[model samples]
Target: MTGWWCASRVPKWARAPIPRWRNWWPRGGSQGVRSSQDYVRKAGAAARMMLVNAAAARWKVPATECTVERGVITHGPSRRRLRYGEVAAEAARLQPPQDIPLRDPKDWKIAGKSMHRLDIPDKVMGRPVFGVDVALPGMLHASIAQCPVFGGKLKSVDASVAEKMRGVKKVVREGDFVAVVADSWWRADQALQKLRIEWDAGANGNVSSETIAAMLRDGLADPKLPQARKVGPNIPRPTSTTPPWSRRPARPG
Candidate 1:
Protein backbone atom coordinates (compact mmCIF):
# COMPACT_ATOMS: atom_id res chain seq x y z
CA MET A 1 0.00 0.00 0.00
CA THR A 2 1.13 3.56 -0.68
CA GLY A 3 1.20 6.27 2.05
CA TRP A 4 -2.25 7.19 0.80
CA TRP A 5 -3.68 4.05 2.36
CA CYS A 6 -4.22 4.78 6.06
CA ALA A 7 -6.25 1.67 6.94
CA SER A 8 -5.61 0.10 10.31
CA ARG A 9 -7.24 -2.23 12.81
CA VAL A 10 -10.21 -0.73 14.61
CA PRO A 11 -9.79 -0.28 18.33
CA LYS A 12 -12.04 -2.36 20.60
CA TRP A 13 -14.05 0.64 21.73
CA ALA A 14 -14.75 1.82 18.15
CA ARG A 15 -15.22 -1.46 16.31
CA ALA A 16 -17.39 -0.90 13.23
CA PRO A 17 -18.51 -2.97 10.21
CA ILE A 18 -16.62 -0.83 7.71
CA PRO A 19 -13.01 0.31 7.52
CA ARG A 20 -12.53 4.10 7.64
CA TRP A 21 -10.23 6.15 5.41
CA ARG A 22 -8.48 9.02 7.19
CA ASN A 23 -6.32 12.07 6.30
CA TRP A 24 -8.20 13.01 3.15
CA TRP A 25 -6.61 15.57 0.83
CA PRO A 26 -8.55 18.84 0.80
CA ARG A 27 -10.65 19.21 -2.37
CA GLY A 28 -13.66 21.19 -3.50
CA GLY A 29 -16.74 20.48 -5.63
CA SER A 30 -16.77 17.47 -8.00
CA GLN A 31 -12.96 17.55 -8.21
CA GLY A 32 -12.75 15.71 -4.86
CA VAL A 33 -14.31 12.51 -6.24
CA ARG A 34 -12.96 12.91 -9.80
CA SER A 35 -9.31 13.48 -8.84
CA SER A 36 -9.09 10.99 -5.96
CA GLN A 37 -11.03 7.97 -7.28
CA ASP A 38 -7.96 6.26 -8.74
CA TYR A 39 -5.96 6.71 -5.54
CA VAL A 40 -8.90 5.48 -3.45
CA ARG A 41 -9.40 2.44 -5.66
CA LYS A 42 -5.69 1.54 -5.51
CA ALA A 43 -5.59 1.98 -1.72
CA GLY A 44 -8.67 -0.24 -1.36
CA ALA A 45 -7.06 -2.89 -3.58
CA ALA A 46 -3.89 -2.84 -1.47
CA ALA A 47 -5.90 -3.16 1.75
CA ARG A 48 -7.89 -6.06 0.27
CA MET A 49 -4.66 -7.84 -0.64
CA MET A 50 -3.44 -7.51 2.93
CA LEU A 51 -6.67 -9.04 4.25
CA VAL A 52 -6.42 -11.94 1.75
CA ASN A 53 -2.85 -12.62 2.83
CA ALA A 54 -3.86 -12.64 6.49
CA ALA A 55 -6.65 -15.14 5.79
CA ALA A 56 -4.31 -17.32 3.73
CA ALA A 57 -1.71 -17.45 6.52
CA ARG A 58 -4.34 -18.42 9.08
CA TRP A 59 -5.66 -21.25 6.88
CA LYS A 60 -2.08 -22.42 6.01
CA VAL A 61 -2.71 -21.98 2.27
CA PRO A 62 -1.14 -20.02 -0.59
CA ALA A 63 -2.49 -16.47 -0.84
CA THR A 64 -3.12 -16.98 -4.56
CA GLU A 65 -5.53 -19.84 -3.85
CA CYS A 66 -7.76 -17.57 -1.71
CA THR A 67 -10.67 -15.72 -3.30
CA VAL A 68 -12.42 -12.67 -1.93
CA GLU A 69 -15.95 -11.37 -2.48
CA ARG A 70 -17.75 -8.57 -0.72
CA GLY A 71 -15.64 -8.72 2.55
CA VAL A 72 -15.37 -12.51 2.74
CA ILE A 73 -12.22 -14.49 1.92
CA THR A 74 -12.59 -18.16 0.95
CA HIS A 75 -10.29 -21.07 0.18
CA GLY A 76 -11.82 -23.33 -2.51
CA PRO A 77 -9.88 -26.51 -1.56
CA SER A 78 -10.46 -26.55 2.24
CA ARG A 79 -13.79 -24.68 2.17
CA ARG A 80 -12.44 -22.30 4.82
CA ARG A 81 -13.80 -18.80 5.01
CA LEU A 82 -13.05 -15.64 7.01
CA ARG A 83 -14.78 -12.30 7.24
CA TYR A 84 -12.69 -9.10 6.79
CA GLY A 85 -13.28 -8.17 10.42
CA GLU A 86 -12.12 -11.62 11.55
CA VAL A 87 -8.68 -11.05 10.03
CA ALA A 88 -8.52 -7.26 10.31
CA ALA A 89 -6.28 -7.36 13.37
CA GLU A 90 -3.79 -9.69 11.66
CA ALA A 91 -4.09 -7.89 8.35
CA ALA A 92 -3.28 -4.55 10.01
CA ARG A 93 0.06 -6.05 11.11
CA LEU A 94 1.02 -7.16 7.60
CA GLN A 95 2.91 -4.96 5.17
CA PRO A 96 0.72 -3.85 2.25
CA PRO A 97 1.55 -5.12 -1.25
CA GLN A 98 2.57 -2.63 -3.93
CA ASP A 99 1.18 -2.04 -7.43
CA ILE A 100 -1.90 -4.22 -6.93
CA PRO A 101 -3.66 -4.64 -10.29
CA LEU A 102 -7.01 -2.92 -10.59
CA ARG A 103 -10.01 -5.00 -11.60
CA ASP A 104 -11.00 -4.98 -15.28
CA PRO A 105 -13.54 -2.30 -16.21
CA LYS A 106 -15.79 -5.07 -17.58
CA ASP A 107 -16.04 -6.62 -14.10
CA TRP A 108 -16.90 -3.33 -12.39
CA LYS A 109 -20.08 -3.40 -10.33
CA ILE A 110 -20.31 0.17 -9.14
CA ALA A 111 -18.04 2.57 -11.03
CA GLY A 112 -19.56 4.35 -14.08
CA LYS A 113 -23.02 3.39 -12.77
CA SER A 114 -25.69 5.52 -11.18
CA MET A 115 -25.63 4.87 -7.44
CA HIS A 116 -27.18 6.69 -4.50
CA ARG A 117 -24.82 9.01 -2.64
CA LEU A 118 -23.94 7.95 0.92
CA ASP A 119 -24.64 11.46 2.25
CA ILE A 120 -28.10 11.77 0.63
CA PRO A 121 -29.83 9.80 3.43
CA ASP A 122 -28.55 12.13 6.15
CA LYS A 123 -29.32 15.21 4.03
CA VAL A 124 -32.84 14.00 3.19
CA MET A 125 -33.49 13.24 6.87
CA GLY A 126 -32.28 16.75 7.86
CA ARG A 127 -29.58 15.15 10.01
CA PRO A 128 -26.57 16.43 8.06
CA VAL A 129 -24.41 19.08 9.72
CA PHE A 130 -23.37 22.17 7.76
CA GLY A 131 -20.92 24.98 8.58
CA VAL A 132 -23.78 27.31 9.53
CA ASP A 133 -25.16 24.74 12.00
CA VAL A 134 -22.05 24.97 14.21
CA ALA A 135 -22.47 26.90 17.47
CA LEU A 136 -19.92 27.70 20.12
CA PRO A 137 -20.50 28.99 23.63
CA GLY A 138 -20.88 32.80 23.70
CA MET A 139 -20.40 32.97 19.93
CA LEU A 140 -21.61 36.13 18.20
CA HIS A 141 -22.89 36.63 14.66
CA ALA A 142 -22.27 39.57 12.32
CA SER A 143 -23.85 41.06 9.20
CA ILE A 144 -21.93 43.35 6.89
CA ALA A 145 -22.95 46.13 4.49
CA GLN A 146 -20.69 47.11 1.59
CA CYS A 147 -20.78 49.88 -0.96
CA PRO A 148 -23.07 49.09 -3.92
CA VAL A 149 -20.82 50.81 -6.49
CA PHE A 150 -17.18 50.20 -7.43
CA GLY A 151 -14.59 52.72 -6.04
CA GLY A 152 -17.15 53.87 -3.46
CA LYS A 153 -16.24 54.94 0.09
CA LEU A 154 -18.23 55.12 3.32
CA LYS A 155 -18.94 58.84 3.88
CA SER A 156 -21.11 58.84 7.04
CA VAL A 157 -23.47 56.58 9.01
CA ASP A 158 -26.02 57.18 11.78
CA ALA A 159 -25.98 53.84 13.63
CA SER A 160 -27.82 55.18 16.71
CA VAL A 161 -31.07 53.41 15.80
CA ALA A 162 -29.33 50.10 14.95
CA GLU A 163 -27.15 50.20 18.10
CA LYS A 164 -30.28 50.51 20.29
CA MET A 165 -32.11 47.56 18.68
CA ARG A 166 -32.71 44.46 20.81
CA GLY A 167 -29.80 41.93 20.76
CA VAL A 168 -27.62 44.40 18.78
CA LYS A 169 -24.21 44.45 20.49
CA LYS A 170 -22.23 46.83 18.30
CA VAL A 171 -22.40 48.78 15.02
CA VAL A 172 -18.94 49.06 13.49
CA ARG A 173 -17.81 51.18 10.55
CA GLU A 174 -14.61 50.65 8.54
CA GLY A 175 -13.06 52.44 5.53
CA ASP A 176 -15.48 51.09 2.90
CA PHE A 177 -17.86 48.84 4.84
CA VAL A 178 -20.10 48.74 7.93
CA ALA A 179 -21.24 45.80 10.05
CA VAL A 180 -23.63 44.94 12.87
CA VAL A 181 -22.67 42.37 15.47
CA ALA A 182 -25.27 40.67 17.67
CA ASP A 183 -26.11 37.52 19.58
CA SER A 184 -27.82 36.02 16.52
CA TRP A 185 -27.37 36.49 12.77
CA TRP A 186 -31.03 37.49 12.39
CA ARG A 187 -30.67 40.28 14.96
CA ALA A 188 -27.50 41.54 13.33
CA ASP A 189 -29.11 41.48 9.87
CA GLN A 190 -32.23 43.32 11.10
CA ALA A 191 -30.14 45.93 12.91
CA LEU A 192 -27.92 46.38 9.83
CA GLN A 193 -30.98 47.21 7.72
CA LYS A 194 -31.94 50.04 10.14
CA LEU A 195 -28.59 51.84 9.78
CA ARG A 196 -28.63 55.16 7.80
CA ILE A 197 -25.50 55.15 5.64
CA GLU A 198 -24.05 57.60 3.09
CA TRP A 199 -21.49 56.68 0.41
CA ASP A 200 -19.14 58.69 -1.87
CA ALA A 201 -19.10 56.98 -5.27
CA GLY A 202 -15.98 59.01 -6.30
CA ALA A 203 -15.00 59.34 -10.00
CA ASN A 204 -16.45 55.91 -10.87
CA GLY A 205 -19.99 56.99 -9.86
CA ASN A 206 -21.11 57.35 -13.51
CA VAL A 207 -18.90 54.59 -14.99
CA SER A 208 -20.69 52.28 -17.42
CA SER A 209 -19.96 49.32 -19.70
CA GLU A 210 -19.06 51.71 -22.55
CA THR A 211 -16.48 53.54 -20.41
CA ILE A 212 -14.99 50.22 -19.20
CA ALA A 213 -14.67 48.98 -22.79
CA ALA A 214 -12.93 52.24 -23.79
CA MET A 215 -10.47 51.86 -20.90
CA LEU A 216 -9.68 48.27 -21.92
CA ARG A 217 -9.17 49.36 -25.53
CA ASP A 218 -6.84 52.19 -24.49
CA GLY A 219 -4.81 49.78 -22.29
CA LEU A 220 -4.53 47.26 -25.12
CA ALA A 221 -3.24 50.02 -27.50
CA ASP A 222 -0.44 51.15 -25.16
CA PRO A 223 3.05 50.28 -26.53
CA LYS A 224 4.63 50.46 -23.03
CA LEU A 225 2.38 47.76 -21.60
CA PRO A 226 4.44 45.19 -19.67
CA GLN A 227 5.18 41.91 -21.46
CA ALA A 228 4.42 38.79 -19.38
CA ARG A 229 7.06 36.75 -21.25
CA LYS A 230 10.03 37.60 -23.47
CA VAL A 231 10.27 36.12 -26.96
CA GLY A 232 13.33 33.94 -27.67
CA PRO A 233 15.84 35.02 -30.33
CA ASN A 234 14.53 32.36 -32.80
CA ILE A 235 10.85 33.27 -32.15
CA PRO A 236 9.08 36.11 -33.98
CA ARG A 237 6.63 38.39 -32.17
CA PRO A 238 3.17 38.24 -33.73
CA THR A 239 1.68 41.55 -34.97
CA SER A 240 -1.03 42.89 -32.66
CA THR A 241 -4.49 43.35 -34.22
CA THR A 242 -7.87 44.20 -32.65
CA PRO A 243 -10.52 41.49 -32.99
CA PRO A 244 -13.40 42.32 -35.38
CA TRP A 245 -15.99 41.76 -32.63
CA SER A 246 -14.35 44.27 -30.26
CA ARG A 247 -14.24 46.98 -32.99
CA ARG A 248 -18.05 47.13 -33.06
CA PRO A 249 -19.78 49.72 -30.78
CA ALA A 250 -22.25 48.59 -28.14
CA ARG A 251 -25.94 48.52 -29.21
CA PRO A 252 -28.33 50.90 -27.44
CA GLY A 253 -30.70 49.15 -25.03
Candidate 2:
Protein backbone atom coordinates (compact mmCIF):
# COMPACT_ATOMS: atom_id res chain seq x y z
CA MET A 1 0.00 0.00 0.00
CA THR A 2 2.84 2.42 0.79
CA GLY A 3 4.39 1.78 -2.59
CA TRP A 4 1.11 2.32 -4.41
CA TRP A 5 0.24 5.55 -2.58
CA CYS A 6 3.76 6.93 -2.83
CA ALA A 7 3.65 6.69 -6.63
CA SER A 8 0.29 8.52 -6.52
CA ARG A 9 1.82 11.38 -4.44
CA VAL A 10 -0.48 10.86 -1.44
CA PRO A 11 -0.04 13.62 1.12
CA LYS A 12 0.18 12.99 4.89
CA TRP A 13 -3.33 14.31 5.49
CA ALA A 14 -4.74 11.99 2.80
CA ARG A 15 -3.41 8.98 4.70
CA ALA A 16 -5.77 9.53 7.62
CA PRO A 17 -8.13 6.70 8.56
CA ILE A 18 -5.93 4.28 6.66
CA PRO A 19 -5.21 1.16 8.75
CA ARG A 20 -8.29 1.82 10.87
CA TRP A 21 -8.85 -1.91 10.79
CA ARG A 22 -6.62 -4.30 12.62
CA ASN A 23 -4.04 -6.24 10.62
CA TRP A 24 -4.32 -9.58 12.39
CA TRP A 25 -2.63 -12.82 11.39
CA PRO A 26 -4.67 -15.82 12.32
CA ARG A 27 -3.49 -18.75 14.42
CA GLY A 28 -2.20 -22.02 12.91
CA GLY A 29 0.36 -20.04 10.89
CA SER A 30 3.96 -21.17 10.39
CA GLN A 31 5.81 -19.44 13.25
CA GLY A 32 9.17 -19.35 11.50
CA VAL A 33 8.88 -17.50 8.19
CA ARG A 34 12.32 -16.30 7.12
CA SER A 35 12.20 -16.69 3.35
CA SER A 36 9.99 -15.05 0.73
CA GLN A 37 8.50 -18.43 -0.19
CA ASP A 38 7.05 -18.71 3.35
CA TYR A 39 5.14 -15.43 3.09
CA VAL A 40 1.37 -15.50 3.50
CA ARG A 41 -1.22 -12.74 3.75
CA LYS A 42 -4.85 -13.02 4.80
CA ALA A 43 -7.99 -12.30 2.74
CA GLY A 44 -8.23 -8.92 4.48
CA ALA A 45 -5.21 -7.77 2.47
CA ALA A 46 -7.10 -8.36 -0.77
CA ALA A 47 -10.09 -6.38 0.53
CA ARG A 48 -7.81 -3.52 1.56
CA MET A 49 -6.49 -3.23 -2.00
CA MET A 50 -10.06 -3.08 -3.23
CA LEU A 51 -10.72 -0.25 -0.79
CA VAL A 52 -7.82 1.69 -2.32
CA ASN A 53 -9.45 1.53 -5.75
CA ALA A 54 -12.90 2.24 -4.29
CA ALA A 55 -11.53 5.42 -2.70
CA ALA A 56 -10.52 6.66 -6.17
CA ALA A 57 -14.07 6.12 -7.44
CA ARG A 58 -15.41 8.35 -4.67
CA TRP A 59 -13.27 11.15 -6.19
CA LYS A 60 -15.12 10.93 -9.56
CA VAL A 61 -12.47 8.75 -11.27
CA PRO A 62 -12.93 5.12 -12.26
CA ALA A 63 -10.22 2.59 -11.40
CA THR A 64 -9.27 2.37 -15.13
CA GLU A 65 -8.45 6.12 -15.33
CA CYS A 66 -6.55 6.31 -12.07
CA THR A 67 -2.99 5.27 -11.32
CA VAL A 68 -2.10 4.98 -7.63
CA GLU A 69 1.56 5.32 -6.82
CA ARG A 70 3.77 6.64 -4.00
CA GLY A 71 0.80 7.87 -1.94
CA VAL A 72 -0.52 9.77 -4.94
CA ILE A 73 -3.68 9.06 -6.98
CA THR A 74 -3.73 10.40 -10.53
CA HIS A 75 -6.27 10.26 -13.33
CA GLY A 76 -6.15 10.71 -17.16
CA PRO A 77 -3.09 11.13 -19.37
CA SER A 78 -2.79 14.77 -18.24
CA ARG A 79 -2.26 13.21 -14.76
CA ARG A 80 -4.74 15.32 -12.80
CA ARG A 81 -3.97 14.16 -9.23
CA LEU A 82 -5.15 13.84 -5.62
CA ARG A 83 -3.08 12.36 -2.82
CA TYR A 84 -4.51 9.24 -1.15
CA GLY A 85 -4.02 10.84 2.28
CA GLU A 86 -6.30 13.64 1.11
CA VAL A 87 -9.08 11.19 0.35
CA ALA A 88 -8.55 8.92 3.40
CA ALA A 89 -11.26 10.41 5.57
CA GLU A 90 -13.86 10.37 2.79
CA ALA A 91 -12.73 6.88 1.85
CA ALA A 92 -13.36 5.78 5.41
CA ARG A 93 -16.86 7.27 5.23
CA LEU A 94 -17.79 5.36 2.06
CA GLN A 95 -19.13 1.81 1.94
CA PRO A 96 -16.68 -0.93 0.92
CA PRO A 97 -16.78 -2.20 -2.64
CA GLN A 98 -18.58 -5.50 -3.21
CA ASP A 99 -16.04 -6.69 -5.76
CA ILE A 100 -12.60 -5.94 -7.15
CA PRO A 101 -10.89 -6.66 -10.46
CA LEU A 102 -9.04 -9.94 -10.21
CA ARG A 103 -5.43 -9.24 -11.08
CA ASP A 104 -4.30 -10.84 -14.36
CA PRO A 105 -0.67 -11.79 -14.97
CA LYS A 106 -0.69 -9.14 -17.72
CA ASP A 107 -1.31 -6.40 -15.11
CA TRP A 108 1.53 -7.40 -12.80
CA LYS A 109 4.37 -4.87 -12.52
CA ILE A 110 6.31 -4.71 -9.25
CA ALA A 111 5.33 -8.02 -7.64
CA GLY A 112 7.71 -10.96 -8.22
CA LYS A 113 10.10 -8.59 -10.06
CA SER A 114 13.81 -8.35 -9.29
CA MET A 115 13.38 -4.71 -8.22
CA HIS A 116 14.75 -3.76 -4.78
CA ARG A 117 12.48 -4.45 -1.82
CA LEU A 118 10.77 -1.59 0.01
CA ASP A 119 12.59 -2.18 3.32
CA ILE A 120 16.12 -2.38 1.92
CA PRO A 121 17.01 1.29 2.51
CA ASP A 122 16.09 1.26 6.20
CA LYS A 123 17.75 -2.11 6.70
CA VAL A 124 20.97 -0.93 5.06
CA MET A 125 20.99 2.08 7.42
CA GLY A 126 20.44 -0.20 10.45
CA ARG A 127 17.30 1.81 11.22
CA PRO A 128 14.63 -0.84 10.67
CA VAL A 129 12.33 -1.52 13.65
CA PHE A 130 10.39 -4.78 13.86
CA GLY A 131 7.21 -5.76 15.76
CA VAL A 132 9.24 -7.36 18.57
CA ASP A 133 11.00 -4.03 19.18
CA VAL A 134 7.77 -2.29 20.17
CA ALA A 135 7.56 -1.26 23.84
CA LEU A 136 4.23 -0.66 25.50
CA PRO A 137 3.63 1.19 28.78
CA GLY A 138 4.40 -0.97 31.82
CA MET A 139 5.25 -3.95 29.63
CA LEU A 140 7.46 -6.52 31.33
CA HIS A 141 10.19 -8.76 29.95
CA ALA A 142 10.31 -12.56 29.96
CA SER A 143 13.01 -15.23 29.96
CA ILE A 144 12.45 -18.88 29.27
CA ALA A 145 14.43 -21.91 30.44
CA GLN A 146 14.02 -25.33 28.89
CA CYS A 147 15.29 -28.66 30.13
CA PRO A 148 18.74 -29.35 28.71
CA VAL A 149 18.25 -33.09 28.60
CA PHE A 150 15.67 -34.29 26.10
CA GLY A 151 13.09 -36.89 27.29
CA GLY A 152 13.67 -35.72 30.87
CA LYS A 153 10.65 -34.59 32.85
CA LEU A 154 10.64 -31.71 35.29
CA LYS A 155 10.24 -33.36 38.70
CA SER A 156 10.09 -30.37 41.04
CA VAL A 157 10.56 -26.59 41.24
CA ASP A 158 10.97 -24.34 44.30
CA ALA A 159 10.09 -20.74 43.47
CA SER A 160 9.64 -19.22 46.95
CA VAL A 161 13.09 -17.60 46.89
CA ALA A 162 12.56 -16.37 43.31
CA GLU A 163 9.20 -14.82 44.15
CA LYS A 164 10.74 -12.72 46.96
CA MET A 165 13.53 -11.35 44.81
CA ARG A 166 13.37 -7.70 43.80
CA GLY A 167 11.93 -6.97 40.33
CA VAL A 168 10.77 -10.54 39.91
CA LYS A 169 7.14 -10.36 38.81
CA LYS A 170 6.21 -14.03 38.36
CA VAL A 171 7.57 -17.47 37.70
CA VAL A 172 5.58 -19.85 35.59
CA ARG A 173 6.22 -23.52 34.89
CA GLU A 174 4.38 -25.36 32.14
CA GLY A 175 5.37 -28.91 31.19
CA ASP A 176 9.16 -28.96 31.01
CA PHE A 177 9.56 -25.25 30.29
CA VAL A 178 9.95 -22.52 32.90
CA ALA A 179 9.19 -18.86 32.24
CA VAL A 180 10.34 -15.92 34.31
CA VAL A 181 8.56 -12.60 33.93
CA ALA A 182 10.19 -9.53 35.50
CA ASP A 183 10.38 -5.76 35.27
CA SER A 184 13.45 -6.17 33.07
CA TRP A 185 15.22 -8.88 31.13
CA TRP A 186 18.14 -8.89 33.55
CA ARG A 187 15.82 -9.29 36.48
CA ALA A 188 13.99 -12.13 34.78
CA ASP A 189 17.29 -13.85 34.04
CA GLN A 190 18.33 -13.41 37.65
CA ALA A 191 15.11 -14.97 38.83
CA LEU A 192 15.48 -17.83 36.37
CA GLN A 193 18.97 -18.59 37.69
CA LYS A 194 17.60 -18.65 41.24
CA LEU A 195 15.00 -21.29 40.44
CA ARG A 196 15.79 -24.69 42.01
CA ILE A 197 14.62 -27.38 39.62
CA GLU A 198 14.97 -31.14 39.51
CA TRP A 199 14.34 -33.42 36.60
CA ASP A 200 13.40 -37.12 36.37
CA ALA A 201 15.98 -38.54 33.97
CA GLY A 202 14.21 -41.96 33.88
CA ALA A 203 15.91 -44.37 31.45
CA ASN A 204 18.19 -41.62 30.19
CA GLY A 205 20.01 -41.56 33.52
CA ASN A 206 21.69 -44.81 32.47
CA VAL A 207 22.85 -43.44 29.09
CA SER A 208 26.48 -42.28 28.90
CA SER A 209 29.13 -41.15 26.38
CA GLU A 210 31.02 -44.48 26.66
CA THR A 211 27.76 -46.31 26.04
CA ILE A 212 27.07 -44.14 22.98
CA ALA A 213 30.56 -44.87 21.57
CA ALA A 214 30.04 -48.58 22.09
CA MET A 215 26.67 -48.38 20.32
CA LEU A 216 28.22 -46.42 17.44
CA ARG A 217 30.95 -49.09 17.09
CA ASP A 218 28.32 -51.84 16.91
CA GLY A 219 26.04 -49.92 14.47
CA LEU A 220 28.87 -49.67 11.90
CA ALA A 221 29.59 -53.42 11.92
CA ASP A 222 26.00 -54.48 11.16
CA PRO A 223 25.13 -54.83 7.44
CA LYS A 224 21.32 -55.16 7.56
CA LEU A 225 20.74 -52.34 10.09
CA PRO A 226 19.33 -49.14 8.54
CA GLN A 227 21.86 -46.29 8.35
CA ALA A 228 21.07 -43.30 10.59
CA ARG A 229 22.96 -40.32 12.03
CA LYS A 230 21.66 -40.35 15.61
CA VAL A 231 21.90 -43.35 17.98
CA GLY A 232 18.95 -42.69 20.25
CA PRO A 233 18.20 -44.81 23.29
CA ASN A 234 16.70 -48.30 22.59
CA ILE A 235 18.46 -48.53 19.16
CA PRO A 236 20.68 -51.64 19.19
CA ARG A 237 24.36 -50.75 18.79
CA PRO A 238 25.86 -52.40 15.66
CA THR A 239 29.32 -50.88 15.04
CA SER A 240 31.95 -48.32 16.18
CA THR A 241 32.59 -45.97 13.23
CA THR A 242 31.63 -42.35 14.12
CA PRO A 243 29.18 -40.68 11.72
CA PRO A 244 31.10 -38.77 8.99
CA TRP A 245 29.04 -35.58 9.49
CA SER A 246 30.04 -35.41 13.20
CA ARG A 247 33.69 -34.93 12.22
CA ARG A 248 33.06 -31.26 11.30
CA PRO A 249 33.11 -28.49 13.94
CA ALA A 250 29.66 -27.48 15.17
CA ARG A 251 27.81 -24.96 12.99
CA PRO A 252 27.54 -21.53 14.62
CA GLY A 253 24.02 -20.29 15.37
TM-score of each: 0.59, 0.46
lDDT of residue 25 for candidate 1: 39
Residue-wise C-alpha lDDT for candidate 2, range 1-253, written one tens digit per residue: 4345124222343433333336642333563222211111222223345545665567666667776666666776656777666676666566544453344546656455566557778888877666556679999988888776657777888988888988998998877778789998889989888899887766677777778777766666666654453367557534335433455645421
Off by over 4 Å in 1: 1-40, 54-96, 150-152, 202-206, 220-253
- How many clashes in each candidate? 0, 27
Evaluated against the true structure, the overall lDDT of model 2 is: 0.62
> What is the Cα root-mean-square deviation between model 2 and the actual structure?
10.5
Indicate the residue-level lDDT of 155 in model 1. 95
| Candidate lDDT values, in order | 0.76, 0.62
Off by over 4 Å in 2: 1-127, 206-253
Model 1: residue 162 alpha-carbon error in angstroms = 0.7
Shift of residue 247 alpha carbon in model 2, Å = 18
Residues 1-253, model 1: lDDT tens digits: 2111123222332222234358433556878557656766666677788889999999889999988876778898988988888998999899867668998888776667776656777878888666678789999999999988777999999999999999999988988899999999999999999999999888889887677767776675576754512256445345454533455645421
